[model samples]
Target: MRRRLIIVLCLAVVLVVAARLVMVTRDLPAQLTGAHFEGLRPEPNRLRAFLHRMPKGGDLHTHLSGAVYAERLIAWAIADGLCLDPAAMVILSPPANAPAERPCGDEAKVVPIADAVAGWRGQTTYDLLVDALSMRWFLPTPAVPSGHDQFFSTFSKFNPATGGSDWQRTLARTAEMTVDQLRQYQAENVQYAEFMVTLLEGEDRRRLGEAIGSEREPKAMLAALEQSGITAVVTQKVEELRALVARVDEMRGCAADRTRPGCGVQFRYIAQVNRNGAPAEVFAQTAVAAALARAAPSIVAGLNYVGPEDYRAARQDYRTHMRWIGFLAADVPVALHAGELWLGLVPPPDLDFHIRDAIETASARRIGHGTAIGFERDMDGLLAEMKRRGVAVEIALTSSDVILGVRGRNHPIRTYLSAGVDVTLATDDAGVSRIDLTNEYVRAARDHGLGYGRLKRFAFAALEKSFLPAADKQQQEQKLQRAFAAFEQEVTDDLAWPDWLAAFARALLPRRG
Candidate 1:
């Protein structure tokens, strides 16, 4: 009887020890990470943890047309019962303004994986239709057609494809896609936390009409666009985007149900107005974003104008446009794509002045594609001013980085980072670039050699540079700090559970599950 009793006791003790061992090993990564936050291991998973833990500030830069994922676009197209030509794999359009010929010819569209990859790049052209979009120009000669030209010219190609459609249903599908992106992004992020949610709306389309500058009925186009409820349309679009975010928050609840906080990561809208668009359109979208900012919470923030700054009217009235932006900046947050340039597009004087003008005149809160900052006139003076204003910059790795990837290493990210320019890495267009926020994170780690500490700092910088207002930002930043500190403390604590439990078992246990 005594021997049997001893065996039972021994077995119980062994089981208890085994349980403890399992718990410790299962959480080994977390424990190790907690214990040595600074000396964190170097690997993708470690990098992921750093990214996940870091409070992403915001993605202040993204273009709507390009921001749409290609897969979703294909799915949307397929759902709409849009047919494609087998030969070219481009979606056919109804004969509204087309010559009797079908856009995709009369064949079924194919998604050959190899071809899709190649076509996704500018290495080869797919059968995407060309229309006089607010963003693209039909070229008579190939003189101006470089990769840069083709790159900037795509919005015009596809924007018309979406025009005059049932935007509500379209938004419903878009919202669905956004939900997927949010999960995919929660699994990662883009533009970091800012989630630069772009919406193609009223002023931009009309501006496209204006840029086209045809005498062929501007009033009719404006009237039609207005009827389409583009402003109302975009506002609804914001809700759909919110739907995706809500699901992400839901997932957050599921993951960290107890003793955690809400994901206050934000979403900001840039009512994309093309530089090549009509002055009226730019002004209108700017107004829309400003209004939305006042009405919406930290969620709906700001306005921005995108496109190459080399258009005729844009250059002519560049200062005038800045003055308009300055006026709007009083109420609305502004981020502008300034100084995204190549050698021959603009004069040295123009490139020299654009970014500074974007800051001073347009009151850009953040600068997108400040790629030419090194070349701008009084560049140091401007840099000093930018730093003074705390105007963070977004380094779009996918699109702008390609300039560096192929030829000249055109991105100024390293320069910006070194100069204490508040910099965040972003995928400018995931669809166009075939990259995402995760990809950006991976790239930043590998290419830039950013470690966990720095990645955390960069993530923090994104939130700081976000368009979120002062008070909300302060509160969120504090929360982020508290979260980091709390986790760090829990992780690095040397006290074993036995000690903790003996002292405070009842205190630690939840009142209810």
Candidate 2:
């Protein structure tokens, strides 16, 4: 009798599981039909939800400072005991002398940290600061002229809030900011990000430049730059980078078998050389980046040229900077910011050669912006080279619209695609631009009429063209492919069944019991 009872119980367990599996399988066909029907729309709400659920391969063009939103920056500032100059919308390390000007109200000459805190305590004051610090609540006002100026100018306003380049705090702050960004990416289903992180600036940068001196030859310059004690400077920054990577990994539980959302995603840093600086400074910065790449290959993989592309120094020494990059790129990789200008934004001559030079001279593996590709001399030839070399262009659709006022047909996305060049979408400054990776896809689909298949290819290209090593890139690609298959299964085979199927399963299952 005991043996019979155990047999019956085991049979009962098997029967229940079998019944559940049958019910799940019976409903799959109807579920797939519904999904097929819903997949036809290219409009907003539906498409946004679709892309949001889709796996984005990576975000290859995000900036660290511009990735953290304003509200968080303010919170960080307050926590750091930093005061706000509400009048100028700048965060300052407490007033040194006092009584320069009032923060919010004109009544007080100087606003104490306590006063600043109290002022921002109100929702309205906080919102005002958010608007000033980012593109949030942005409107064309007499005081603020163009959206382009407003977009770029936010960096200056929040520079003090980021605590500047004070070595003791810079790494910790950057790591925390990157962690926040990783959370955002995970929420959006993005699996990777390459941050354009600037780890050195101010006196440290100046000191490094002095050490490197003024050698113009690539070989000799690199040799001199190496022996100039610049490695000590780079070593200090590399230590910071290691600490940052370690903190992020810990927060994400990277070493554990089951990691959090943050750890599920991988992050790599690309050191950005400040293009607005002088030639020697640019060389020094490049050398430092090369060293970082050598010392911290796990975290730092590439170098970039970052700044206002239309700035005088960047335009004047454009080729020279590319030469510096080309020299370093023999041992490292680069993704340069080129052709960010528009027709009227800079001289026509500036627009004609940037994209060409970055590719031909710098041998940049990737091009960020590439907005002015249409204006390049021998545009056809350039497109062919891009295709031949498999150089991917990182398009930030939202920022392009805000800064260059280029969207829809005015944007060169179709040109790149039609020319057979590899293209991927990125969030140039998600926090500042108030947009995310999904927004880029949505814009690409809605405006450019990109189908689901075309969009998925963009995601694939992101990882394929990334700076990750061969084995890592292959592994990431496989992971992405798996994610896509699972997504398809969830939407097509596991969706809610039709009413008739659910009713049929319910009625049939009970009768079987």
Candidate 1: worst-modelled 10 consecutive residues by lDDT: 504-513
lDDT of 1 by residue, 85-110 (tens): 33433443443443334433333243
Cα shift from native, residue 226, model 1 (Å): 14
Q: Enumerate clash totals for all models, in the order shown.
A: 12, 0
Residue-level lDDT tens digits of model 2 in 1-513? 999999999999899878766764675543332334234343568678878888999999999889888888888887776666668777666544544464333435334434555643656667777898888878887878888889988998887667665665777787788888888888888998999888677787787677657767878877776676777887888877887888877766768854576777888999988899878788888878878888888889898989899989999999888887877766788899999989899988898999989988888889998999989999999999999999999999998999888988999998999999999999999889988899999888778777666788899999999999999999999999999877766665544457345433443332210
**Per-residue lDDT of 308 in model 1:** 62
Please list the residue runs of candidate 2 whose C-alpha ends up more than 4 Å from where it truly belongs after superposition: 1-43, 95-114, 117-121, 212-220, 494-513
Positional deviation of residue 138's Cα in model 2 after best superposition, in angstroms:
2.0
Best-performing candidate as measured by TM-score: 2
C-alpha TM-score for every candidate: 0.65, 0.85
